[model samples]
Target: MTGFFTVCTMEEEGADPVIAAFYRAALEPGQWHAALRAFARLAGGDVACCFLKAEAGLAPSRAHICGLDEQAWEDGYRRYYHAIDPGYTVLKQGMPGRMYLMQDYISARAVARSEYFQDFYLRAGVRYSCSGTIRDGGGLTILSAHRAAGQGRYDGRTRLQLQRVLEHLPNVFRLRDTAQQAQVHGALAWAALDELPRAILLVDACLQLVFMNQAAQRLLCGPPLAPSLASATAAIVLRGGKVGVRATAVQQRLAQRVRQVCAG
Candidate 1:
């Protein structure tokens, strides 16, 4: 389990209650605002920023920010900081175990105080920023935390705490998705089959492993399975009077059956 994350062991006079309150709020859904503000106050900076890598040419559309409004977000996109933003482009190269801090940007202070970033920060009330990558073999997820004026810039200790949050964010999401998927699967018997121990694989007509369970996840991705590593999502099984191509065979069989009935 992750440790309790705080900037320092010793707290300023009368600061504990305030920080503890934010700590409690962070646990509640839709209460990130308290935590974000707490981080800024703790860091002695002003802003808290968050980032998620997005599809190309859709920076404005997909950027995730905490303090700013749509106009600054749109302005950042229209102005092309999405491209110039070192955190976005640089952090993509980072692996989970590794992390980075922007200690020496030629335009670091300048850009932070620039007409552009400042407007976004001032309007949004953010003073500091921290970003980290969260990815499993399943896919990629990145989160950036932000702050505004007097919300101090991140220090080494703060960075480590933020990194801990980065790692946990994915698991947090998995739990959320599992809950949501459970609600959906409960309504459909076919999908509810996923709860079973059997290795059930759902493939499109194309024979891809669109979904699989722990049993299948282990088998198909293990040494025993003969799926091609090059395939996007795949598994091996017998179907249609033959072995290995269950998805493809299932599609072909269904098509043949459909054709026969149509002819009749």
Candidate 2:
């Protein structure tokens, strides 16, 4: 499991918490906001975001933002300003795992003069940015940390910390993909089982019922199996949360069989 991760020793004490947040966000995409918050805190930025960069002339998608007005940012920046932003262009062309400061692509004077900066960045209160690309296969998966106009640009130490975090992003993406596939396969398997005509009951090692199909439910609700059984209504009874046979001898036999199967 650990083999999938990049080998990097993060000297900062915050590394573990940041990594944990990223992994949690990977497993559950809704947690991305929290992950971004952690990223922002670790990188010493006011805001952080993750977004996918598509082909030229196209707006980014799957944006997870923190410490900003989400709707306004998406509407103004992604929909309009992204196409004209030089920093974004540089990010699109930047190498994966390599951090790029806004200053590297466009000078502060140039940014202040550009329409993209005046109309969007100034209005958004974000002037300085440090960003990096993690995955750039079909589309670029970019992570960016933003600072307000007065706040200083991300320093060398912050850049190094972001780099360390960037090294683990691929593993997060892989884990998310694996989890999605597993969920898809699980749904399909359950659907197939539900459609089966035969009664099916899934039980644990102690014959405790884990799951039952529609056929199993129907069968369990039907008439009693034999008059000789203790219970006249049904052959199977859910007693103490375990699948139980009404007849004593049959219950013992079922338990024995289940035990053998579990052992094997």
Candidate 3:
């Protein structure tokens, strides 16, 4: 959501840089590794990972991880440990934007006895986990932060921080899907968009204008929707580098709709 970006930017004079990196990764897939590392540090986690959980199984090839071995994740965990992982099962059922602690669902003693823990988790040095479902349509996109044995379990403070971050995950997922679609179609897609009769505008997570089709440009410059002058009211206006509707009632409804779309 755009509100998430605004809050993060204003909090403690921009102490949390992870939010910016997180959004960047949504736009550019290659930045995910660095984004995960920043996220792990912010959550006080030793490792952070994000992957899509499909009906078949976890798609390890598409996973972005920090502080974990890629080979072990693909070969060892996906092949053997995924089915036996209690944490994985709980995460699969977790509500989008809600955080879940593995310790709450299963006891430490139970985890110690499990083959998944003995064979994979113990080998990987991961013991405690805090995860949440980001989006669940075609597949479940899960974001998880893990703590090593000596690091202890995630505390209340950590959980609160993680939950705040989780609120923005759905927006990031939406941006990623948009980016992928654009990449798939390339410049031809832009040309097609320009020819559409309806006015179209694309904004970033921060609500900054990124692209506006020719129709949108014409609409903005048209007489009925012309830039507002103080003496005469106009349907639309551009002020302070942002688009605005002159009518308070129309503006309120438009803003609400924008927030709903951005919240995704």
Which structure among the candidates has the greatest lDDT?
Answer: 2
TM-score of 1: 0.47
- TM-score: which is higher, 1 or 3? 3
TM per candidate: 0.47, 0.64, 0.65
Model with the higher lDDT, candidate 2 or 3: 2
Tens-digit lDDT track for model 1 on 91-179? 66666533455443315677665654555444556534566666543434555566454645557876665555455455344443454
True-vs-predicted CA distance for residue 10, candidate 3, Å: 3.8
lDDT of 2: 0.72
Q: Which stretches of candidate 2 lie over 4 Å from their true place?
A: 1-12, 186-264
The residue pairs that clash in candidate 3, if any, are none
Between candidates 1 and 2, the one scoring higher on TM-score is 2
Compare candidates 1 and 3 on lDDT and give the better one: 3
Tell me the tens digit of each residue's lDDT in model 3 across 208-259.
5666667677766555543443233335556665655667886677577567
lDDT of 1: 0.47
lDDT of 2 by residue, 110-204 (tens): 87699998988778888888888876568878888888877777788778878777777876777566667768676644454454444556677
Q: How much lDDT does each candidate structure score? A: 0.47, 0.72, 0.69
